[model samples]
Target: RIDAETRRILLLELQVRPGIAALQSEQLVAKAFKTKVNMLRSLGSRVVMTVLEEVLPAAAREAFRKATSSSGAAGAGRGVRPAASTAAPEPMPVAPEEHALAARPPPAAAPPNAPQPAAAPHAE
Candidate 1:
């Protein structure tokens, strides 16, 4: 049978092994976290550089070019123009029937007999 002192030594050794293993596990987790944080930081820096160096300058240049090339008319600052209507233009002489209809006043609202919509409830 093992002596009491030897048994105590073995117990302590066993305890130490698990403690070392836990410490190693903690170290691994910390390393992985650090690596992930660094990778994210690098990615964020790259994205910022791409936007500031490439995308922003390109967009600014395009906007400047458009503004400079736009028409000289008043209120034409941004190179944007009002879209022209695709529908047919008004006829030179207005039709008599159409003029009469246009001159007539709009019809009145629903009669008193008609059911009215329910009013929405107000919240506090």
Candidate 2:
């Protein structure tokens, strides 16, 4: 256990100056903001959460929303999963001649004697 703690401490020590020369400005900002977050966490104030939300990407925000929904921690931002069909689909157009045929339900399985597509001129 002491060895494991020492390794963890060394890992954090190595990352102490993270993003000092990152190509992107966001990487540097994220690292700096993390230090402030640690301070806020230690002080036990949740006000920083609002600030944290501002830094998260849209994809991460969406994943967090989904996770919150599944974890039953939902409230104001309840993570209700979207319904399969929230909007009714528009009905497809059917040819006048095929209206009667379309009105009938389709067969569950094709009979071996069913007409092949090659036998129908309008199959296409």
TM-score of each: 0.22, 0.24
Candidate 1 TM-score over all chains jointly: 0.22
Question: In candidate 1, residue 24 scores what lDDT?
Answer: 73
Could you give candidate 1's per-residue lDDT for residues 3-57 as a string of tens digits?
5665455445444455467677545545555665566555554344455566567
- What is candidate 2's CA lDDT for residue 114? 98
Deviation in angstroms for 104 in model 1? 95
Q: What does the lDDT read for residue 77 in candidate 2?
A: 38
Give the worst 10-residue stretch by lDDT in candidate 1.
73-82
Q: Give the alpha-carbon lDDT of every model.
A: 0.60, 0.58
Task: State the displacement of the C-alpha of residue 98, model 2, in Å, after optimal TM-score superposition.
Answer: 98
- Model 2 local distance difference test score: 0.58
lDDT by residue (tens digit), candidate 2, 6-109: 44554465564554554454444455557755666564323444554798877886786576457653453332233468788999988897988878898788
* Model 1 score (lDDT): 0.60
Which stretches of candidate 1 lie above 4 Å from their native place? 1-20, 45-124
